[model samples]
Target: MRETSQLPAPGSGAFVFTAQEIRELDADLARRDLLELTMEHAGARVAEVIHARFPTGPVLALAGGGANGGDTFVAARHLHALGREVYVLAQGTRHELAGRMRRRLEGLCPIELLTEERLCAGLSKTRVVLDGLLGTGFVPPLREELTQWIRRINEAGKTVVSLDLPTGLPSDTAGDGSDAERVRADLTLALVGFKPGLLFSEVGEVQVLDLGVPPALLERHAHASCITPEEVRALLPRRVRGAHKGTAGRVYVLGGRPGYTGAPSLTAYGALRAGSGLVALYSRAELPRHPVESMAHRIEDWNALTALPRPDAVALGMGLGEDSVPVARRVLSWKVPVVLDADALQSELRGAGHDAVVWTPHPGEAARLLGIGTGDITRDPFAAARALQLAYGGTVVLKGGPSVIATPGALRVCLAGNPGMATGGSGDVLSGVIAALLGAGLSAPEAAIAGVYLHAAAGDRAYARLGYGLIASDIAHEVAPAWHVLHQASSEIL
Candidate 1:
């Protein structure tokens, strides 16, 4: 396979549009021959994915009575032509498009009544399930029968693939508002646009399928986006033929107190592994066991720390404790790009130089920064990230399940990380990665985006190898592999 990023390029990713925006795009397309064309293309794409993934399987297609059902019927028709046994459980509507497709399926395959008894009867024989029960227009508090079917589908333990959005998740928002239940899929295939719910919620690995929507139409409407490895490949700095350490970038890490000596070392290690030529760790307390890859320096006082030669970028506040405030204040005057994390956010921040800083805060730290509750931040992460950026005047990374990266006019979310990365020291590693990228010549926003993406991608790779027992250092080690993968893709593309 060609080593391109998972998502296609131009922007290197799709613009995640809200449900209303998608509807507006649909209406505009419906004015032409585009709506039917989109449905045909969507069905073909879903069929192609299913064929490639589960080639010779007795498949079950759970379809609704609207356009979603029509898409399912199309896939079923394609599967039947491939000589696979395709069973469809469809309910309700006799809508025109759906009706036409169902008639086609009747001639080619089996169409069963969507009842609990029939569903349970078919579960044992089916290997894969396609969820097309609801589209983006679905609301919460699903019908009791539908809920029962969803529960049965879940209990079957079959690999479920959902089209568009999952059955019950709201297309516009990340949080499931009511106590309504939804289908939990092993793979969710989103068509046309990206939705925050699909990226943030329990819907498993998601891939944005091209519905053949014109790039011009997408460009006219899309704003928010997700970052891909190809974009990072294009953005990462390269080592020239005769490059030396001095030409490559210097990253300074300032943190680590009495008992927290490991934080600074991890920060320096992350920067070094992320491709910084020279990484130096300066700590208030002596860390005799600092990583051999980085040079260790002593910080007797604020004056000693600032007296050192200027670095291309600085990573601050890994474990400075209460001394973080003074250390961060001193560095603010240095006028270098800085990545502030952990206790560094505790420092009182103000003034014009805020634009040079990249703040990485968990919800609790974000709550502290905005003087709001953590609940509010989790309810709407995009808003919280934007608020933090506007308040601080730089890039803000709101670290959570699906970390949100916000700058002045842009927002991007990374969907690669897993629950294992919630361990301590991960944020410090992220800070170091951002600082290293900044030192290597990317702008503050670009560094934040690339850093967050690479950090998460590394965590994903580590998770695949070691599972949930992953510690912070494991992710740091994987950064090199992640960088290699991204760089390799770039080289092949060029």
Candidate 2:
């Protein structure tokens, strides 16, 4: 086990573990007689959560004959011991529960064995259905009976509380295009550490209960942050009294071809709004004739990049089209950090300064960079991201829901943001946000993670103002408000 003292603070993707990996860790725990102790601890923690949330029930636990089921049995015993009328709906049979679990249940309760018929029959009025039928164990496409059962429960709108992860959904993609058939729970009590599926997938609003996995044991394999408010606060530039605009950071936004100019202009504005000291735009066209001219204070020809004042960081390819590729090569041989988005990433991982580049790609752009199909990258993004990060020799922001920020050994998921962020031009704003934070003295990964979280949070705030009608500019507009809320609170709290 890696030392707990050495673990990165939670939000930096430093705690979530895979089911198989955790099972091995638990085996190591059991060889030392710690599995029962761990399960007991887990059950009690779950019980505490149920108590706090419920006022009354006909609580039905859908127990499979597995560790997750065992946890459900343990929870039932504790609740029944406290005089709560709780029942176990064994999805499997008594014969299936014949090992240690049968012995454990011997003195506990009259475990009413469950069937597909029983589950559907009773779930209509049950106060809560504890989804213990599957943990992070099953990947996708439940047995036909289970799929139909989920559809019925969803129709009835019954309250569901899943253990570990919802049943039926692949915790890591081994499904046949049916990701939607998984259990949809209202409350998921994630044990040990958070699993990637819970955050990256739309399971539900999640609550992580500490189950006494020794702090030392967890640091060994898991490296996912269940991002907290405090960690979100530490991302920024420290302002010195004598600091000038250039000294704080000079951010230059480039890349807007004949057909595409709004993208780079938006990128430049996003940098200024994120608090970069000075923002300059070097464009190929003159003001007014170019759509983004109002935002591009400075313009330069394609060959003028060499003579332009040195910028602390550069953002390239928001609007840099395929035709501009030749010009891009001639110009953007960057000395400082650069953000490579859109067309820039489609080129080889390294052209002039790949080591200093930050590649922000939607799955499509990412596929081009990896020389693989988008489906392959989408099915297993974790592996794809690690591959790309090593190939590019820089931080990789695999942007999407629960945006993945990975750099070699590290992989962090940003839990901030909302559904209102699916508008066009969102990526354009994101490229700029990352550049500004990078210029403002954040390391590439820090800037990427913080920039994604803040950008999403700003999108959410923008939605509050204008709902789904939100454009990219509205999100950029809310960046300051969101930053001030977190920054001032950060200055106050941490």
Candidate 3:
């Protein structure tokens, strides 16, 4: 198998556009007489990626009767020029194609009309399939004939590379609960900008390609931005040589009942590992030892929080259990930089008016807070995170396969985590990391972004060594190394 090339991190100003916005930009470029050039760039990039990634392979290009097909025809021509055996499967007859698409089709080798038998034959002979059957204009509830073809292509098991997006998937929303069948591509070449639908798992690995659209056009229509390592590096808190325990910021973790002590301990570990000067755990019951670097305190009442020395930041609600509602209320009233996770995410606490708060909730917890089903949260995490932020009046981190961090003005997606990070207590570690960053004086959004990146990067590092067997503790232990790597990279850049 050919090794996948590492996609360069998008610039900090990179923004994601909707399908309609992309179309508008396309029309705008067309008026400027740059549309054809953009299409050529897209085709060249697709062919070049296929040539580099698939190396020696017979490529079968599936073309529909649209601009998407035009791109496919151009790619097929380029692939043939590169000496690769290529086949073109056109969805319609040459007479059905129009204008640019028709001209592009005439440039290709004799194209075969798309049919079940021909598709099967093409699949059998090809090592890579380019899916140009649908682009960003696709809608849900795909036609039965197209669904059948998609199913066949998926079953064919060829390394399918989609031109813009997989066929049958809409551009507006992520997969959500749609019953429509879509082509499962191994890679998707996002033309010009990313669509929200590409954020899901079904789209596989995404590589955004520039289609020569001016950056200003994309920024004007962009709905959200992606989180990159470079952005996280810039957000990371810096420490001076003179910094000591008193100067490094203190984090107070308040959670952990009798049976769920592990959660609070992991949070403390995460805070300590993420560079908090001191971490103290205040739990309902304390019968066991915690991290050596962290102090443990047993709290009998909510009022105990009032007496405790004010820390720079606080992380609450990990395994706090059913009785945590009162404690959460008291803590929210403090108005210090706080990260609310797990049991602390109470509906009654919505809009608690904390000046600086970060809520880290998985889909289920987020649904509970929003009074909706978990499916709604999964369908469009961007909207869910935004809703959470609006309701709670703070930064919201909607944790998932690719987590969404929503601030007042921006929606950011973190794509660094892995399946191994889905283990229990993983979110507790994230909460602690965020709290640590907040304690170190970063804004809620800055801390959440940097912490989410650090936590995910650590999980990725642990996965490299321990594979699926890696646990939450492994991720916590890897935080220092992840931070060191990012810090080193940032230093080199400087």
Best by lDDT: 3
Question: What C-alpha RMSD separates each model from the true structure?
Answer: 4.4, 5.2, 3.2
Question: What's the distance in Å from true for residue 87, model 2?
Answer: 1.9
Angstrom error of the Cα, residue 107, model 1: value is 6.1
TM-score of each: 0.84, 0.87, 0.92
Off by over 4 Å in 2: 1-14, 91-102, 139-157, 174-180, 226-228, 286-301, 323-332, 490-494
Q: Number of clashes in every candidate structure?
A: 0, 8, 0
Q: 1-494 in candidate 3: lDDT tens per residue?
A: 11112222433334677788888887888788887888888888999999999999799999887778878888888888898888899876342222365466565566888998999999999999999998876766787889889989999989999998888888877674343488888889988777888775355677888766777877777778778788788888889989999788899999999989999999998999999999999988882857989999887876767888789999999989986678777777777899999998889887674758999999999999999998888878888999999899889999987788999888887767777787898999999999999999999989988998899889888988997788998999999999998888744452
Worst 10 residues of 1 by lDDT: 1-10
lDDT against the true structure, per candidate, is 0.81, 0.70, 0.83
Show the lowest summed lDDT stretch of 10 residues, model 3: 1-10
User: TM-score winner among the candidates?
Assistant: 3
Model 1: residue 337 alpha-carbon error in angstroms: 0.5
lDDT of 2: 0.70
lDDT of 1 at 394: 80
